[model samples]
Target: MPSTSHTAPITADLVRGALDLEPTANGILPHRLPARARARNTDGQLAMAESQPSGVRLVFRTRATAVELDTLPTKRVYIGAPPRPDGQYDLLVDGRPAGRATATGGNTLTIDMSTGAVEHTTGPAGTLRFTGLPERDKTVEIWLPHNETTELVALRTDAPVEPAPASGRRTWLHHGSSISHGSDAASPTTTWPALAAARGGVELVNLGFGGSALLDPFVARTMRDTPADLISVKLGINLVNADLMRLRAFTPAVHGFLDTVREGHPTAPLLVVSPILCPIHEDTPGPTAYDFSRLGEGRLLFTAAGDPGERAEGKLTLGVIRDELKRIVTQRAADDPNVHYLDGRDLYGEADHAELPLPDRLHPDAAAHRRIGERFAAHAFAAEDGPFAQAEE
Candidate 1:
């Protein structure tokens, strides 16, 4: 364990990329969305997702060989599935992986959709320790858990620390669903978007919300207002799994979303990515349902509940969404050449699925996140004739 020999308070100024921070009784809780937007958002799911700090981190420069951060993370507990492990804190030294740790003891929110019952219980905050560094002055980053809502209580190190030096990389703003939210990823630094951003040498502003990327106007507006050099939105699976809207509503919603974004970034490279191959929702319309049979075994999987015949009635399937997204981007590109589209399958298709199956039957596993991130970097960030062709320099 790292020694808490030299302690320093972690103030709001030390956090980077968080839109807002609320002072808590013990410390501070970082928020990815502003309070005004949060006030306007009535959806509990959206509120929780936005407050989870997907791309937020504590960044600093230090000469210490050991460090510790005390935090209270609010972790979710699902009734049907086994409890998720404590959220991971990723440590990076001079832009490279150093170590990973998880804080112990925090509140728990146990939800039971089967009965519409909810329970909340509190626990003690714990420390995340990282020891044995190079002992030279270096930039260090501690990426907060993307899946847990954490309240930072304190920071301790063997030496004083300051904010990290800026990398000056182009900022990449990306939005998507749970897959983009780092679900099942080992840590915040390894999410597909995080991996892709690291490989492409871009700063990340992630808007990935677990089961909550519904092409909301506020989300689009938020992306518009945020300063980003490269932008991408991964769409489809959430729509299919949630069965949120039919094709008629979904089409206009997408247009509205893009229209809102382009209002602020008129000429920036914008990429629209369709969903990857989720065989369960490929040809079938959905309202994906839980596979209760595996629940007792401590494995949870989802199956498309909507019928294939519903597609003719304008119900959405991943295939339909992909075709529509491609068509929309292509049509708009006739006038707006900076806007482009990439098939999600290009990042992770049927062949890749056979090799790296989605453990939850929907969200990709950690290894799959790595694969998708690498592929996305290759196809979108490095390929010639792509929107980010000049970004390679």
Candidate 2:
């Protein structure tokens, strides 16, 4: 018999890439791709590389903050999809256009529904290279069209890549509202969750959706099924903003959410975070709206809540919701030692609010994001046995 060393044949299926996402009626899934390059050998016969694109995920998670005076020029801003027919995205970085690109033809990157990976053609591939980026720590500001639908698929950075080591460090799964989702933040890496993850020296899986951080049963189920060494849920705010539930429904819903997560992560260290200070919703119930006619050249008007009844019902306020989150987490902690609670106000309070007022009176600005990240790292991940600490060997 002849000695045979056969290599597996490469097929079209092997050559194809995909990005899987939960289905939506519009057939568009909102997602922000990892800002890194990836390559793999398929069937030990061929290699492929996927690069990050210049789009951010599209979703109505947070509104833009007021343009600041100290904005840096070196950063780049990325918007999802493309500029609308109005040519309205007047994105500025230090008062200049950041980068102009359209999502057209094969140039438009898409999220592969089957695999959750962002995919785009490399044009005859042989090492697809994406260029154009400013140096590190620069500020990027995105001005999205009001009421426009968008999907951010990927991000690119100019900073040096420091790949995580093969071993060591804990893995943290952070679930939260828009702030954790990089709302109003300059870059994906600058999001408070990302910043805290970096400072704490851990790998992070961010499930921080912008406006989708409600204590939904489906979300709880997703959290229950997902695996992580550490986990955190940032609650409140959205509940208050949407006025999704009454006090009676709110408390039980939180309990049910935590109960479900506990089913899978019984012993894992879990932290529940409430909303930080927001004077707009601090005492009053709100369906917040913006009068953009004055700011955006009178061409755009933004409306969030149409129901005044919900606001008047006094059902949802950050003050009330925060208390409920604390109560539920406290009660849950009595039965489980690994569970912990952190007041969102501790990370940011009225004093900080006075100094760094949110442009929309909700989400934090970039500087506030940095402050919150640093504070979280100090209080939540300071010690080896801290709230974000890994399970002991």
Candidate 3:
């Protein structure tokens, strides 16, 4: 914590809508996933995604022309691969895009999949300062990088800052995979979920973790316990890509996940969303692989390596997951009407694909994110039978 004697210091409390903030020796670690649930997660993917702080932002009321944030970010580096984009920090003034930044000087974690070995080398923390804003006091938001695992070290502004008052908008809690994690999206605010939240006029608590969003019980329990007027879980892609479970295990896991979430939010508008169209994974089973041929061409692409024949063995596919999701939601909705299902294809389908191809063949590009967000806002939040209509009303 920096001294507020000169410039006022802001803490995680000023960072509105985070699921949980755990005190760390450095400062505070904003966790989209809670500690108890994290303990149950043995997968490294979830650990990295949770710490990335997608949709996490520092919200405050300030008149300062300049604001500075000190952060320690853990960035991953893959050997024999192109460098990942630098982490981006998005700034909003009075709920509009104001500026953007990339924090330098962070620890690097070297990953070598050839040997399944990892190494970390620490670096000094860096400060990001956003300045030249209007002098009048206004609501300001600093959206943390959606990809880098960031630990907030300190927050300082030229003027004293206070937590921004609640916007009175309903909170939308969403859990999904990389596409929802802002995978190929240009910036934090441009992420599909964030764009949807903005378009729907709601506060967002995004649980979209890249390479995660498997039907983890802890995630469901977290959603169960969180305060949200609207909740949604986008399923399928990660499970298919990771090949973590068979259809037998997946079906029950989805059911159990929903069952657990209902334990806390029995009546909240809980929407179950199936994965959107991924041509490669629609019929083919995955463990997807990166197309390294395009890798050197300055384009990174992924291909579904799982054979189409694997479906005979009950392997999971997006098509299969979608059917199962629709079936489960329909069956559950008969007894629990507040629960609903949205075909992910409705947001992005074959038609949308023809116009806006997924650049990476897995994640949507920035424009596609906006398109999905708009479609989602219309269908899931604004439609006559939408879950949000009942919940928000």
TM-score of every prediction relative to native:
0.96, 0.61, 0.95
Among these predictions, the greatest lDDT belongs to: 1
List runs of model 1 lying over 4 Å from the truth: 1-5, 391-393
Which candidate leads the pack in TM-score?
1
- Please list the C-alpha lDDT of all candidates, in the order they appear: 0.88, 0.54, 0.87
> Candidate 1 on 1-393: residue-level lDDT in tens?
546587777876578768788988979999877776677788888888887877788988889999889999998998878778888889988889999998889998999967757799998898888989888999888999989999999899988888776778888889999889988998999999889888888888888988888998888888889898989999999889889999999989999999999999999999999998999999998898988778778898888899999999999999999999999999899999899999999888889889989887898898899999998988877778767656433
Candidate 1: residue 61 lDDT (0-100): 85
lDDT of 2 by residue, 1-393 (tens): 211222222111111111223233322222222212012112110011111111221111111222111110111112232222321222333323544322221123344323445544322101111224343433343432111223222222323222222335576777777777666665545668767876887756666666657675656776787767889999888776666677878888888988998898889989998899887777766565654444444232223443434545557777788877788888877779988888899999989988997866678988999999989888778866678754466
- Model 1 residue pairs with clashes: none
Put down candidate 3 lDDT per residue, 13-79, tens digits, no spaces. Answer: 6886577788766778788888888899999878888888899998989788888888988888888
Q: Positional deviation of 32 in candidate 3, in angstroms?
A: 0.9
Residue 64, candidate 3: how far off, in angstroms?
A: 1.2
List of clashing residue pairs for candidate 3: none
Error of 2 at 4 (Å): 34
Q: Candidate 3 has what TM-score? A: 0.95
Q: What lDDT, from 0 to 1, does candidate 2 have?
A: 0.54
